[model samples]
Target: MIGSFVLLNCKKNREKEVMMQLKKIPEIKEIQCLTGPYDILIKVESPTIEELNETITWKIRKISDVRTTYTLKINEEATDCKDDN
Candidate 1:
């Protein structure tokens, strides 16, 4: 699966609406409202990168009051744990 993180910059007074709208999209697995440069952060997973690209570009970017978005594709895992028998 392809995993990605999206940072949303919403118009003033539109954070709640934006979050609600985003939640309806099925691929958006997790979301959070944050206090920082970005108003909301979202994690999404798809079967492939192209599918993710379409969701972000077509569905997400088309929302009203969404000022802009910065997307990062998750590429690698920093660590993994295993137990030796």
Candidate 2:
């Protein structure tokens, strides 16, 4: 599995619209409105890196209000931690 956190910068006053659009995509697992340089954050998962790339390039980036995106791919091994529960 491949997972990534995408930080999105959108055109002024378009955050909500962009978020709504992103929610329609199946690969986007989570979307959060943020208060910072970036307007929104999205968590996406895919079976392969190629599919993820396509989703980002062809789908996400195609949103008219989206200005830029910064993607951080998760490293499962480094992030794995046993739960204290």
Candidate 3:
């Protein structure tokens, strides 16, 4: 699996509208409204890196109010929790 964390900034007060639109996309696993330089944070996942790129470029970026996006590709996972069977 491939994953990316996308930080988004929307035009004016369009965060809600953008969030609504983002929810329609299947690749977007999570969305969170933020309070900072960026307006929202999005978690996207796909079976391959190419699909991940396409989601970011074609789908997410095409939203009407989305101003800009900064994406971070996840390279590794570090966790302390383990499942007990």
Clashes of 2: 0
Q: How close is candidate 3 to the true structure, as a TM-score?
A: 0.91
Instruction: Report model 1's TM-score to 2 decimal places.
Output: 0.88
**Cα error, candidate 2, residue 18 (Å):** 0.3
Q: State every prediction's TM-score relative to the real structure.
A: 0.88, 0.90, 0.91
Model 1, 21-61: lDDT tens digits are 99899999998998988899998899998999999998888
lDDT of 1 at 29: 96
Off by over 4 Å in 1: 78-85
- Please, what is the whole-model Cα lDDT of each candidate in the order they appear? 0.91, 0.94, 0.95
Give the local distance difference test score of model 2: 0.94
75 Cα displacement, candidate 2 (Å) = 1.0
Best by TM-score: 3
Per-residue CA lDDT of model 2 for 15-64, tens digit only, reads 99999999999999999999989999999999999999999999999999
| Residue-wise C-alpha lDDT for candidate 3, range 4-71, written one tens digit per residue | 99999999999999999999999999999999999999999999999999999999999979999999
Candidate 2 TM-score, true structure as reference: 0.90
